[model samples]
Target: MNTYKQIEAEILAASNILITAHKSADGDSVGSSLGLLHFIEKLGKKATICHPDKAPDFLDFLDLSHIITMDQEPEKVNTAFQEADLIFCLDYNSTDRVGKDMTPLLESASCTKIMIDHHLDPQDFASITVSDTSASSTAELIVELIELSENGSLLDEKIGTPLYVGILTDTGSFRFNSVKPRTHEVLAILLAGGVKHYMIHEMLNDTNTASRLRLQGFAMSEKMEILDVNSVAIISLTKGELEKYQYKKGDTDSLANLALSIKGMKVAIVLSERDGIIKISFRSKGKVNPVNALAANHFDGGGHANAAGGMCELSMDETLDKMKALVPEYFPVQ
Candidate 1:
């Protein structure tokens, strides 16, 4: 049986399904979780979506009021996990990716666990895993899964919207190397299903707040530092700086991408100071593998080769020092 057939058979045999995505929920995470919930509901199954963190305002276009959040309602989250007969973990690989609070709850849940992700070196935690590291996003995988099912008609506007958001955000609006011909094929099918592609793009990118624009200007003028010899650009922001601008969850969404747009820049780094850790985002062009060298080796993080994230428990300057120390090793003066 194919992935959809196999998953659908399991779904048919079970009810009370709970779906989850990782913490600091990105577009792909929100899209896949909501999209899957809609699909399951269309199949006449009891489905609930749970996310470990709050989603950004940019994704408010999608109706996520029903999506349970651990931050907002712990009891609801716990109840959903407890009553769930089958849990589909979307977007993320490891259970811990859901965050510290949800890890044990998810790991201890006595249900058939399913993982559908497109990340590298996924842990063997789920009973069934539909992982494809090469796939653009889990939302793309979701499209394939729905097409493989007997009820391909469920890929309508409601479902296609979130799926399109996932593909658009995760693939950097079709500019990333991860995007393939199959990705566009799926996008075409979504468009044919009446997904408002241009509108979705406008919401995701053009709907920025005035404060967000001011914050971006500050990031470019005050925080950005170009390492000319190494072909790198670094933008470091402290908690105070973030608060000064009233930083929202997705305020710094594409700052790294902006930094990388400079001429001769091969790598872009965003160092953001949080409560107890420095959140790091790495963006690279060409062959430099941030997932292996920057994220995995230097910091306890990983993602795609071209775009990865990491964190450090040190002062902002200290974190920059550490990152600078590793720069020569990875980028070397070229």
Candidate 2:
């Protein structure tokens, strides 16, 4: 049986389905999970989305009432996992991506697990793993999954909206190199089917709060450091600074990309102190200058070459110094 068809079959057979995304949920995670949920619904089965945490406020425009979060409703999340006969893990490469809170339960769940992701080095966990690193986002793969299924006609505006948002944000509004001709093709199909592309873009980017803007502004003007010797830009924010700006989730999400916009910068990293750890986000362009090694080797984190994340046990200032010291090794001046 074809894999996508088998996936469809599983959806049809399952009595209760639960969909999950990685912790620190991003656009692709949220968008892909919801898109798959709606697809499952079209098959006459209702699915629950259990995210590890709440999505950033900008994406709150989407109807998320059906989704249960580990952070907000632990027992209900546990119940959803217990009830599900089949599980779909979206937009993450590994089980640990669900974070410490939900990892043990996910690993222990007796149900059949299917993983759909677009990341490097996917773990050998899920019974059905669809990991396509070449795809722009997991949402792209979700569209492909729907198209490959016999139920291709079931896709409608409800499904396309979040999937389109997934593709939009994961590709940095179609700016990243991970995007391919098929991405635009899938998007074309969605757009033809009445997905309002403009609205998704506006809701994701245009809904920033005042605190979010101030936080970003302060990070750029005050905290940003440019290392011309290696074409690296760094922004380090203490928790106090974050609190002062009334920081919320997703507030610092764009800082690395903004830092990388500088003409001379080849790598951009944003580090913020939270929960006694320095959380880092890395963003870069051009395959010649990948940032994943800096994340994986030095900071105990890894993702795509261009976009990755990590955590440091050191103080914010110490982490910043360590990053600066490590820059030349990856993005050498020569």
lDDT of 1 by residue, 1-334 (tens): 8667899898888879989999888999999988888888888888988899789888888987968899999999999999999999999898889999899899999889999999888999999999998899999999888877988887899989999999999988898889899999999989988899989978887888888999999999988988888888999999999999999888998898898888888899999987578999888888753534678787888888888888899889999999888887888886
| Cα shift from native, residue 303, model 2 (Å) | 0.9
Per-residue accuracy of model 2 over 1-334 as CA lDDT, tens digit each: 9889999999999999999999888889999988898988888897999999999878888787767899999999999998989999999878999999999989999889999998888999999999889999999999999988999988889998999988998888898899888889999989876799888878887888888999999999999989888888899999999999999888999999899999988889999998789999999989888988888899988889999999999887788778888888888876
TM-score of 1: 0.97
TM-score of each: 0.97, 0.98
Tell me the alpha-carbon RMSD of every candidate: 1.1, 1.0
Scored by lDDT, model 2 comes in at 0.90
Candidate No. with top lDDT:
2
Runs in model 2 deviating more than 4 A are: none
Residue 138's lDDT in candidate 2: 95
